[model samples]
Target: MRLQGKLAIVTAAASGMGRAGVERFVREGAQVAAIDIDPAALKALAAEFEGVHTIAADLATEQGALDSIDQGVAALGGADILWAHAGMPGPASVEDLDMTAYRKAIDLNITSAALGAGRVAPHMRKRGGGSIIFTSSISGLVGSMMSPIYSAAKFGVVGLGKSLALALAADGIRVNVVCPGLADTPMKLGFTGRSGDPAEAAANEAKVVGAVPMGRLVKPGEVADAALWLASDEASFVTGVALPVDGGFTAR
Candidate 1:
């Protein structure tokens, strides 16, 4: 009940961290509007939940972002919490990276977040307060050999959150970024791309485990919990922080 009666909008909510956040937000008493590009999954989610609004839209585009926000506002009465969590893992290195792919990754990961926050700010400000949570990553704080473009995009998110927090403090809006480490989610699975080889996937996953001091990948729910805190009154005085929910992955 931490978010009782609040209106929340979460992007990329069809699966992975975004999906987890939608469920968590609802359980915490928030009226949630979930957005995703997958129509089938969006339909399934809408079928599974009551009072949850699902929108199928490509957030990488301005029109898509605007439409999603407009619908969420119409559904929820107003926007109180904004979780801009849509992202794609880009190429591993500069040498092998495609320029088009890199730009698209940035659009999805960074630009989409900017648009979401920009649209929600006026509504939030009108209500006299709100919380905006950006999904950054530990990669944002450090270099990642696995995905340079993704790291850059995430890093941009952290910067965006901080800037917004400072700019909106006078208006009573709080902005913060959550930087999660390796997490066991559909997106993580996709990164490995194990072709019908469970053992190889396990081994690949194990490598991630060894890198974290906690000895295991973080769970989507764990990240959701952190997000819940950030979006709730418990973090009333907290803003402009890029918090690491990385299980000590960046401790070194």
Candidate 2:
């Protein structure tokens, strides 16, 4: 029970790393508020988990991010952990610089996390201390030729996390960021499948996988494990760190 006696609020909790984090936290003895844009997914999650409180809210807007945190804290009484994990992949090429998609990517990938953290920090302070985990990408640490917009947003997340960690450290609130690489999540698959060509998607995934020193994609559960450690007492002394669970993708 690594997270025993804790209350957590997880954004993007319907699927991918968010869902995995929720499942792992619950099993480790934490009561969680699972927030996602999909009401159907939230309902399914609530039904699957005995004590999970599910909230349907878009995390892409400032109002949505704040309101989600409010609802979660109300439902769980207070929050000891906040995992602002909602994000999206933006335009793949500089030629396709759709401002709409690019702005949405910034809002969802980094702005919401910033808003959520601002909203949740006071609650954590009231509770003595807490842990806040944000999701970045290996692209955040480096750069990406495939998606410059994505890299920009992810880099913003990392910087925001570090700033928040420093700001909240005195209050006993620890903030950290997780950088994932070539993960086998719906988001990754969707990116590769965007061309609607099976062979192309397969080939794209293969090419990306070839770059990982571990010779495989990182699993959602593996990312969850890292978040769990950051949330639990095990990482009490850790803060302001951007840990990469990329199977050595950043090692090179």
- Per-candidate Cα lDDT values, in order, are 0.89, 0.92
For model 1, how does the per-residue alpha-carbon lDDT over 19-93 read when each residue is reduced to its tens digit?
A: 889888999999999999999998888887787998889987889988898898888999999999899887767
Q: Residue 238 of candidate 2: its Cα lDDT?
A: 96
Off by over 4 Å in 1: 194-201
Per-residue lDDT tens digits for candidate 2, residues 101-198, read: 88889999999998999999999999999999999999999998777888999999999999999999999999999998878888885567678799
Superposition-based RMSD of candidate 2 using all C-alpha atoms, in angstroms: 1.0
- Check candidate 1 and list the clashing pairs: none
Report the C-alpha displacement of residue 173, candidate 2, in angstroms. Answer: 0.4
- Best by the lDDT measure: 2
